[model samples]
Target: MQHKVIIAGGGTGGHIFPAIAIANALKKIAPEIEILFVGARGKMEMEKVPQAGYKIEGLDIAAFNRSNMLKNLTLPFKIIKSLNQASSIIKRFQPNAVVGVGGYASFPMLWKAQRKGIPTLIQEQNSFAGKANKQLGRRANRICVAYDGMEKFFPSDKLILTGNPVRSSITQSAVTRQEALMHFGLQDGKKTVFAFGGSLGAKSISEALRNILPQFVEKDVQLIWQTGKLYHDTAKAAAVPYASHVKVFDFINLMDFAYKASDVVISRAGAMTIAEECLVKKPVIFVPYPYAAEDHQTFNAQALVSKKAGLLIKDSEVGKELGTTLFSLLQNKALIDQLEQNIEKLGNSNADMVIAKEVVKLMG
Candidate 1:
């Protein structure tokens, strides 16, 4: 009998990519197994999942508004409606198990699966447990976490410490520095700096880049700047004069090449990004997004900072500190080497496959 599994949740690439990783592992283990994704209606998963060649269902759901309290008045209704939609989807799919990677639509769907007496697993990617995942932990048959010290969040016995799964392109990587530089059209002799502000883009980071572009060009530094989709055009226009020293894009699907080409990386401290940085063993200056769940991005960066694995500069402090932070790291080869060595200690690029194997084991 073919086992049907549902992987749910996704607002950002962090959640969506992990779901894809598990799905790929599951298919490798059992080619005949069935898989489906249930994501928030308007989220990126709607596009990303299908592009990855998986069937997906979208629910009309949204997270309770944290920025504007009044907007949460509709949340109760949205939750009830989403629950009804989730139950219907599960009834039709009849999944053997459901795996949640953490996002808005995951709560109702996984809760319904638990009520039906079906097994459910959760992959929590953050150092800090999300409120929804914390609530789900009590009933979850398995909890796969990417960090240690998660005993405070979930039952220690139920927790499986699998590191986060990075994209396959990066995990099984052989992209040489020369090839990566050629792909970016950058000269081999020049130092390259990588920059990105998550998938949605960070306004402050983009602004800081504008003020610092001339400086980078003057220093003979090359850049692989991914200026999140929202600010791509603006960043491009501002960075026009320095095009000789820059490669700007909204996204880079070929991350293995990007990481290999760069000498230093300036980035946001999302779980997935941090995992990838560790896997690549690159020096980084992390600009943690202050509003991330529980300010978890700060915690993620702090973990690196404490270990001297990476430098941390908060989002709120970016305007004044970001440029200086990147400047120091780019110029200091010893500091860069120290960070690369320390961060590499935390890399577990195979966690996706490990997590999948464990989830399948529990299903039996």
Candidate 2:
């Protein structure tokens, strides 16, 4: 019999990209396997999954509103509705195994699957597991994790340290440094810095960089800055004075080139971003999003900082500390080389394949 599997979850690129990677890996290992994706309606996954060439069913699910209690009045009803939708999807798909990649949709889908006695797996991408994943982990057949010491959140025996799957383009890019610099219209023989804060953009990082734009000219440093959509206009306006050396964009479609061209990186500490940074082996300074669930971004950055693989600056301290820290690191070739060496050791180029194999094992 041909095996069918359902990979569920996705809200951000961190979840969506890894989910896609695993799907591709499963196809590579078992050409006969059939895969489907389930995601929350109106979320990024609904669009991104289809773009990745997978069939997806969307649940009318919404996460609990922590900031506004009034907004959560309909949350319980939404969950109940999503649970019914999840059950219907499961009944129709009849997947041999279900994989939860961590998002709002994962909870209802994996819950229904486990209750039906379907083999299920959880991919916990953060150093600190989300509440939904932690609850679902109890009955999951296997739990693939990116960080160490996750037993506190899930069953110890079920945990596999497969690392987070990053985009293959980043891990296996052939773009040369010279070509990359030319692609961004940056000058040669100058230290380059690439700064981004995820898809929506980070206000603090953008503001901090804006405050220090003049320093880039003095130090002969060039930059490729992805300010995200919200901050693009403001950042572009600010970079006018240094337009010759700074390239500003709302989103960067060619990250492999960006990685190749940069001598240093400044980014928010999302799991997917960290995974890519490690694979690219660039020296990075992470500013963890303070509002992340359980402050997990800080924990993610700490895992690297502990090994001297990366540096961490708190989101709140970005304004005061980012400039000094960034310029100091850019000037230190020895330290940058050390960071590159240490971080590369943490990259797992085969995480998707390893996770795919484990999912296949559960299928049997």
Candidate 3:
């Protein structure tokens, strides 16, 4: 019999990628399994999930606006509407399990599933739990987490540390440094820095890179930078003088290549990014997004920094600290090697399969 499942989440790549990884793992284990995705109506997942070859249902839900309190006025009504839509979808699809990966859309679907006595799972990617996941945990059959010490938020018996599920291409990357360098049109022997501040370009990281553009050229370092859409034009203009030493993109679809070419990485400390960095075994400098819910990004980075597996800089310190720190790390071969070996130890390459097996077991 075909097992049917619904995976829900995505306001960012951190959630969407893991949700897709889980779906892919399920398909691999049970080829006849039917999977569906649920996400916010106009969010990235609505577009990305279909591209991953799965059908998705979009809800009319909106997250509570943290920056603008007035925008949350209609949040209750929207939640009610979404729950109704979720009920209709659940009735029609008859999924054996519903998995929430932590997004506004997931809450309603998972809540409805739990109320209806269907198996429900919540995947919490960050070290700090989100409010929705915390509340949903009361009824969720399984709470899959990436970090330890999450029992403070969920029942210990319900929690499972499966790590964050990363895209298979990243976990099983086979591209060599030479091939990756050639793909970016960079020289093989040059020290290369790959920097990205998540799917959306971080203003601070981009601005800092803009100021340090000339220094990268002077130091004979090559760069593969993903500036996200917001900083693409500015980053392009800033790189013109050092064009030969830099390759800049709004988004790098070929992350496996980027990871392979990089000697060091400068990145936002989102859970998925940390997981990928660990798997790639590269020395990383993390600039935690200070605005993340509960400032979880800092918690994520600190876990590695505490173990000498990664380095951390505050989001506020990026301008004064990022360039010099990154340059110094590039020159420190012994430190870099130590960080690589230590971080590689933290990676769970089979997290997707582990989560998939557990999902199946819980559903049964």
Candidate 4:
């Protein structure tokens, strides 16, 4: 019989892209394998998963509010409703295995799958475990993680250190620097820096870059900036005067090209971003989001920083430190080459295939 799998979770590109990569890997191994995705309603996964050519079911789920106690009043109801919906979907789909990537809908979907005695896996993409993943770790059949020290959170036997899965386009990109620059209408003969703060944008990074825009021009450094949705308008207006010196966008769909064009990258320390950066083998400066669960982004960057593969700047210190640090790195070809080589050693190009093979073994 053909194996049918259910992959769940996704609010951010970090989760959505990896989930799709796993699905793609599974399909490659067994072209007839059926795969489905379950994500929170109104989340990015609903749109992104479909765009990746997979069918998805969305549950009316929401994460627990840490700041507003009143907002969590309806959380229990939402969870219960989501669990019931998940149960119905599983019963109808008759999946042989269920995989939960971290997101609000993951708990409900994994809970339902485990209760039905189906094989279930959970992929935790962060260096520090989230509360939901920690709880699900007990019941999940396998816990696939990106970092090595996850035994502190999950049972040792349950943990498997499969590095995070990055999109194939990025991992296998052949886009040359000249091609990438031409695509962005950027001129050659100058070093280019690419800055992005995940899909939502980073205000601190954006503001810091805005203030240092003239400095970049003075140094003849070109920039490709992804301001994300929140800072798009502000960043666009700021870039208008220096169109020749910078290319700013709310989102860049062609990240493979962007990575190719960049001599250095400044980004949030999200797992997916780190994975892509490693594969691309670029010199990087990471500004971790402070509010991430247990400040995991810092830990993610620290893993690379410890190995001299990347540099880290705290979110609060970006305004004071980012510009000088970036310019200094831009002038250091030796340090940049060292970072590239060290980071390239850390890349795991076969994570998707590794996870897919594990899923097949568990199914049997």
lDDT of 4 at 187: 90
Which lDDT tens digits does candidate 2 get at residues 171-226?
A: 77899999999999997788999999998889999999999999999888999999
| Model 2 residue 54 lDDT score | 93
Tens digits of per-residue lDDT for model 3, 108-223? 99999999999998999998998899999999999999888999999999999999999988877788889999999999889999999988888899898888998988999999
**What is the Cα-based lDDT of residue 152 in candidate 2?**
95
For model 2, state the Cα shift of residue 297 in Å: 0.3
lDDT of 2 at 235: 92
lDDT of 1 by residue, 14-111 (tens): 99988999999999988888999999998999999999999999998998777899999998899999999999999999999999999998999999
Relative to the true structure, candidate 1 reaches a TM of 0.96
Clashing pairs in 4: none
RMSD of 3: 1.1
Per-candidate Cα lDDT values, in order, are 0.89, 0.94, 0.92, 0.93
Tell me the tens digit of each residue's lDDT in model 4 across 26-71: 9999999999999999999999999999999999999877789999
Better of 1 and 2 by lDDT: 2
Query: 1 or 4, which is superior by lDDT?
Result: 4
Write out the backbone clash pairs for model 2: none
Give per-model CA RMSD: 1.4, 0.8, 1.1, 1.1
State residue 91's C-alpha deviation in candidate 2, in Å. 0.6
Ranked by lDDT, the better of candidates 2 and 3 is: 2
